[model samples]
Target: HVTLVPSHPSYAVISENKRQVRYQAPIHQPLVKVKYFYGVLGSPSITSGKHYWEVDVSNKRDWILGVCVSLKCNEKWNFLRPENYQPKNGYWVIGLRYANNYCASQDAVKYSDFQDSSRSTPSAPWVVPLFMTIFPNRVGVFLDCEACTVSFFDVTNNGFLIYKFSNCHFSYPVFPYFSPMTCELPMTLCSPSS
Candidate 1:
């Protein structure tokens, strides 16, 4: 499963207004990377906490056999420590496409649940919890198992596929996405479409 940590733990508080609601957060850029055994493709497009990339369809779209991505929440993710949460907010989220078409032809692609019971627990069950922090905001994929295809992933809500992985491949595409920034407690996330 993917691990999500807010950019700033405490300061990310949501405020409500009849006409509008605001969630203020200290602005600090997040470091992002996409990784797999195939190797690191490139840095991701950063927007808020979400990232993006394109799998080019120029010449070798069919060579891609499998795909996966890695996300680093931030080192300050430890801010959860004071809150009595596990210290692992960064991890890999792997998505496998066994079928030849693999939803590329379908109007909506659905991924299986993110939790796999067969894998060993990293530290504890409830260490870190947040849909935005864990799953890739969206996953855009284009593939041609025989030729070549460009796949796209958007890790944002309603934007892309959400996946759960059973293993952690932390070598090439792994690094903390954000650095420590002072945060305030008692915060709430604002609904995207609110």
Candidate 2:
């Protein structure tokens, strides 16, 4: 996620309307050992309270939406692989792929299990597959820091709940995540009135 508060992203192009971000091609091997795609994070990260945002995904099929838990990921990894994103890796996100497949990034183990005295391995990614009856034109992301939950709504279907992540341990401030994916379509950030 790009921290607009600090600086703008170099790999993604923001439209003149300032609502859409189209990521550019990958720079030959990035600072990290791997090559990852570009994505954006909204400014003024949420430390508390509830926050909601919507993305216009009417024409997009491959994308990712949710909240990112680690601001440090930008400084450390610079860019992250989608496969590395999980609750344990400081990302609570849902993704769409292959035009129809939907899934949420989950942890193989519970959060509290690691906090115990035993030094076990970190949580592995447990992607839960999701099936939607209707493809939403706009997806609403709601983050409740107090409840430690993030929920996604299908705005096109009377705000129906698509999926929700519970008992999230947000270590850092949460930032709204947007990944338009490598598709030809662009994802637009929706205004409150729209």
Candidate 3:
């Protein structure tokens, strides 16, 4: 079994056992700054080979799970911004919002010239819907460094594929990331076999 690290409390409120984390303030709370509720990265970044991990998000209202570049404790980045979750920023994630929508982040594309096939336009990164399903109690993440792929599975449903990010460019070591947004329920890291 691999060890899983919870998010740092400075970025979010981590549980005593380091198995769960939550944003301190709710979205409707007054004077609550979004910057105070950033997500956390797991320890022991993956350098090569295949690795798998699972997170228990049962009864959680909002959360995000996936892999990201290992950021130092002292390093500063605006994770609260929407653009920070894109591949260009070293974040490839799938998340469930309060409205029960599941989506994957992707870079936006546009056709600069309608008549010309070669001309294309670049826009901000955005998310695309994968499907509409109830959030799984336990989500499994499989990362294949050599294959440049990251896949998520619904552990509660016969290990069904939730989403997969293929052809990912890994310039640096990456780690598992988790964010339980404003939900009191803990997000526990589960054994891959479980």
Candidate 2 residue 146 Cα shift, in angstroms, is 1.0
Candidate 1 worst ten-residue window by lDDT: 56-65
- TM-score of model 1 vs. true structure: 0.21
Best by TM-score: 3
State how far residue 155 of model 1 sits from its true place (Å): 11
* Higher-TM-score candidate of 1 and 3: 3
Instruction: For model 2, give the 10-residue run with minimal summed lDDT.
Output: 1-10
> What TM-score would candidate 3 get against the native?
0.81
Candidate 2 lDDT, tens digit per residue, 46-112? 8998888888887776788788875445664335676667877777888887789989988666545
Residue 146, candidate 2: alpha-carbon lDDT: 93
RMSD of 3: 3.6
Q: RMSD to native for every prediction?
A: 18.1, 4.9, 3.6
Report the lDDT tens digits of candidate 3 across residue range 3-56.
446433344666666666666654555865454336777767789999998998
Candidate 2 runs further than 4 Å off: 1-10, 26-35, 76-78, 109-124
Provide the TM-score for each candidate, comma-separated. Answer: 0.21, 0.79, 0.81
Error of 1 at 49 (Å): 5.3
